[model samples]
Target: MTVANGSEPKDNGGVTPPGDVTPSETPDNRPSMSDLAAGYAGKAGLQRNSAGHVDMLKSAGGVQGIAESILPGLVFLVVFTFSRDLGPSLIAALAAAAIFTVVRLVQRRPLTQAVAGVVGVGISAWLANTTGKAEDFYVLGFFTNIAYIAALVVSIAIKWPVAGLLFGFVRNEGLDWRKDPERLRAYKLGTWIVVAVLALRLVVQVPLYFMGEAGLTALATTRLLMGAPLYILGLWVAWLVTKPAAQPSKPSSSAD
Candidate 1:
């Protein structure tokens, strides 16, 4: 169900249930659940290249995006480790994020990721500065991981796994995969794979977080390592495991 650029998707012969309003027929023209799922999959940091292979780096937003995500925290960790000054460390981190935002603005590119980086850096700086504890900078990350784990668990419990919504759409299976028990089970497993990754972060970092100022460097380093890189690895593994089995090819007819 791959859709090419500037082309309409071919119908997969799906039928809308009776009394169900299509997107066009909706009063406010709000997108359907399927539409929302598709949009999420597109941004889930998983993409198939022209060769039909998953291009993890491209999906992770290329080299520039990866640097934008890591450098601010890296800057903070390095500066604070040497100077032991929260003020300068926070400024350096904020500057790193702000530089990315400025580059995006100057390049006339979409500001979504860059602006998000700036906002996240700003919050971490504020939390650490206000509490006068360098460790507080990572407090928000703990809550974020817990929230995602909870969401994924809930989705699996409801039998509409997050991985199904994400990977199913990316694979062009749409919501139809939910009707297949085998695929449904595979997606549930995939969702748990994601849950494990998020859980691993909390398990490893929370203890270091509790160590207070003394554990700042280890906590920061672990956070950077387990952040995007771990996520990509987990997602890749889940995707590979959940892939649909290939159908057996039919034999050709003999000449009459």
Candidate 2:
């Protein structure tokens, strides 16, 4: 029997059509490119509200998550500014991260974000302490931005724009959007928007990083402002611009 799309239905005991089959059906059960892309999008923490719009706050990991991300850097900046001591500044930052981890544990929530925050803070602290330069605390962030920009650019170059993989799944378009030239172009533009965000961070922050301890306060402040908040703004814009056009409804036929 023909389905709603006017295609004959398969008869493999309700198995998904070949085009829709996921990697789990394969002999090795290895994930396909689509599965990998979808998993990346899922882990990105982007969420949709009941209205079907991207929830920016939720995507930034809610209030607690935002605090977890910002508190450490803010503590480091404040402590360093007042005491002019790298040791106490690093310790305060690490303490903030640890406190968040403890809070997550007490609440029995998923520890991934908390644990990652702690690790990142620890690395930053270690790097700064080892270098005996407070400015070095943000070095890790520079590398992170570079890595993300590189990956996003490569995805665009390969024509598998990360924005398409991400928003396509979020919007329920799946991989089908790749088949539409207009959708593909829109997604490419979306990917470039994200790329611009990452590049902007480097362009603005890397200069401050070279200014050494003299620019530490400004560097930390900008880092806090441009971190999650800037990222969410860019992602929101990308999501909006890449939105799929509404499908035209087919006219119904009257029965004779």
lDDT value, residue 233 of candidate 2: 94
Q: Flag regions of model 1 displaced more than 4 Å.
A: 1-22, 25-30
lDDT of 1 at 131: 96
Give the TM-score (vs. native) of candidate 1. 0.87
What do the candidate models score in CA lDDT, each in turn? 0.81, 0.83
TM-score on alpha carbons, each prediction: 0.87, 0.87
- Per-residue error at 237 for model 1, in Å? 0.3
Q: Clashes per prediction?
A: 0, 0
lDDT of 1 by residue, 132-178 (tens): 99999889899989999998999999999988877775566778888
Would you list the clashing residue pairs of candidate 1? none
The numbered model that scores best in lDDT is 2
lDDT of 2 by residue, 37-147 (tens): 555666777666767567889889999999999999999999999999999999999999999999998999989999999999999999999999999999999999899
